[model samples]
Target: MAIMAGPGDPVLAETAAERIRELMDGGFVVDADGQHAPVHADDLAVISPHVEQASAIAARLADVPGVLIGTANHMHGLEREAVVVIHPLVGYREAPACATGLGRLCVALSRHRAYATVIVDADADLVLAHAQREAPRDARLATQRHVLAALLALG
Candidate 1:
C-alpha cells in the first residue's frame, strides 16, 4: 500500500519508493537490460487536486527558471519556453504519466529531455528526478532539436 504523509509535509524519498513499490504490487518487473521497470497506474484522476496545487506552485515558480509538470496551467513564462508536455498513457504508450508511478518518470528523466516538464501528479521524486536529469536546466534539453533546428534554419 502507498504510504500517506501529512497534508503539507514533503514526501520522503522512502515514501516515494514505497509508493513505487505499491504501484507495481511489490516485485519490480525489469526489462532485459534492467534500465527501466514496468509500472501500473492510470490517468491523473487519482491526484487531480494535487496536480492543480503543483500547477499553482509552478505558476508561482514560473519566470524563475523551472518547469512544473502535471498541472492545469499548461505553459508558463515568456521568452520561448520549450516545455515538454508528457500526456498520460491511455494504454501502455511509449511515455506514461507520473500519476501512475515513478517508473515512467524514471524513464523520462533518465532518457527523454525536459526542462520544465509538468506531471499530472504531485510526485516529488519524479520532479526531483527530472530536475536531476537536466541539472543545468537546458530549456531545450529534452526537445526536438532537429525539428527546432530545421525551423530555425529556415528563418
Candidate 2:
C-alpha cells in the first residue's frame, strides 16, 4: 500500500519506523509453503534512497530486533517478508537524476517477499509529470515516470 504524505514531508523515516513496529505488533503474516506464518521483526526491512533517511529510520527502529534498515542500494539482492520504501523524491519539486534512476526504485520495491509499502509525497505524480514535461526526450526519466505511475495506479 502507498501512504501519501505532504510535500517536503520530513517524517517519512519516522513513519516507516512506526509501520515496522505496527507490522510486528499486529502479527504480520506471510505465505510459507502455501501456509500462513507470522513474520518476525527480522523478516522486515525498511529501505530509503537517501542515507540520511536510512540512518534516521535505523535510529528509530534500533530497539526493534531483527529489522533491517538501509538505503535502496543496500537492499539489492536481498529479500524480506515485508518492506517499507521511503520515496526518494518525496519532497522534491524536481526529480534529481540519482533519485529518478529506475534501478533504485526497482530494488526498493522488489525486495519484499510478501508485503510492500511505499511512503510517497501526495503530489508525486505532479512532480514526476513536471519533470517528464521538462525532459520529454530523456528516455530514462520517462521510464522512471512510467514505472512510478504503474506503481501508484495499483493503489
lDDT at 96 for candidate 1? 24
Which regions of candidate 2 fall more than 4 Å away from where they truly are? Answer: 1-9, 31-33
Count of backbone collisions within predicted model 2 = 1
Flag regions of model 1 displaced more than 4 Å: 1-50, 65-68, 71-103, 111-155
**What TM-score does candidate 1 get on C-alpha atoms?**
0.21
User: Each prediction's TM-score against the native?
Assistant: 0.21, 0.87
- Name the weakest run of 10 consecutive residues (lDDT summed) in model 2: 1-10
Q: lDDT per residue, candidate 1, 1-155, as tens digits?
A: 12244222233222332333344454233456866543332211111123543444344334333232342223222211123333232111122233334333333333212122222223433433454365545333233222223333543
Model 1 pairs in collision: 67-116, 68-118, 69-118, 69-119, 70-118, 70-119, 70-120, 113-142
Residue 50 C-alpha lDDT in model 2: 81
lDDT of 2 by residue, 1-155 (tens): 23344332447877898889888878657464677666788889998888878887888888887898898888879998889988777877678887788788888889988788888766667778888888889888788777778778976
